[model samples]
Target: MQTRTHFTTRLAALVVAVAASALGCSAQADQTTDKIKSALVSRLGIDAGDIKGITKTPMAGLYEVNIGTQLLYSDANGDYVFNGDLIDAKNHRNLTQARMDELNKVDFASLPLANAVKVVKGNGSRKMVVFSDPNCPYCHQLESTLKSIDNVTVYTFLYPVLSPDSTAKAKQIWCSTDRAKAWESWMLDRKAPTAAGTCDTAAIDSNLALGQKMNVNGTPTVILADGTRLPGAVSGDRLEKALSSAH
Candidate 1:
């Protein structure tokens, strides 16, 4: 009888342990969800009524929040917020790149490719987008570096800065016989194109508006095919490394 009682006691304990474990998992899920909502409400200044849903990600404890049409993330406690490219270190892969790509997408098809001069190097299979000022020395250096790269098609936006003289030169380039040739002459040969002063050209106005929309506060900003932006003139090898790594 004593042995029977001991067995029953052990069985009861096992059942309690299993119940506690299940409850612990449920509680943790709730806590993380609660934290995510609370963090966004307090820090992001987003109205609680507008919050759609928050889903926990496969990336350990991180969460993916769907706020209307947008996606963002917060910590378990909703204490931290960031934009990050989740990578697979073991495979040297970009895991969250596709999601990030959707998040920061550009309408490549709709871009006024004609307003920007096109440079075709090699077979021009690879594509890149560059925003550059006519008078920016760093932009000139980037142009010089770009000439050496092969099999790449470049779309150059006329982002004039430095002074009023730069804008005038950009206008002249847009009105020149060959926009590509005009840009190269200014950047490579340090020769400014003569201003026919054509107000009809749309390149300067279009580029300026696009730059503002892209939050580009500086010159020589380069965007990769995967929608990832390099804020400055990146090195040739490093640029290739970044561009090729996109999934």
Candidate 2:
């Protein structure tokens, strides 16, 4: 009979052996990464620097590749590549998307709350961060939905990605004496903010860089307390569900 400890040790040995055989050498990780990068560049015509990451998956010989916000898969030697979701048939799970979401998520507390327009409702015990563009129609739609939710503290990052007008509008809103009110007025009441123009608006630039790092290319990207990112303007019911699930 195979004891539990023996089984664990044997499994580890098997994994190591498989990796060694697939990679052809147990060289440094840097070397391995370079080899994979070279293979990807040569075979797939992907720029080596554009490939954000390459890592081994749980399944032997399979590697995960990251290009910007998109995910790809390759064999050990990059001989074959796949650009799609990897589903677990037995567990009925979309592993590829799950991994992508996990990688893209950020610590909610780490966000620069001082830079955001803050709004509190009810007790305001629950917390959420929103990356919004002042010029985005979807952000206006989300603002309408958010008005109905309660007991939450909303931190709105003025992420201006849509147009030059969006950045100008974001700076205008940020420069207002009452940022939250200004944002609400603009997004909900269809009123534009009159720019004070003198307030230091460095936070907007920081938010833009942060959004890029987090792979947030779209407006109205909501981040729940548990680091789950919901892209686009989800419905109020779905938003409630996500909040409850995260809680």
TM-score leader: 2
Cα-based TM-score, every candidate = 0.60, 0.84
Task: Report lDDT (CA) for all predictions.
Answer: 0.78, 0.88
Q: How many clashing residue pairs appear in each of the predictions shown? A: 0, 0
lDDT of 1 by residue, 1-247 (tens): 4698899999999999999999999898878787789878988898886666777766776787756434677778888776566667888877566554455566566667777888888888777888898888889889888877788888999888679988888889888888788888889998888759586767678889988766677889887776677767788887777656632
Worst 10 residues of 1 by lDDT: 95-104
Q: After superposition, how far is residue 206 of candidate 2 from its true place, in Å?
A: 0.8
Candidate 2 lands at a TM-score of 0.84
Alpha-carbon shift of residue 15 in model 2 (angstroms): 18
TM-score of candidate 1 on Cα atoms, chains taken together: 0.60
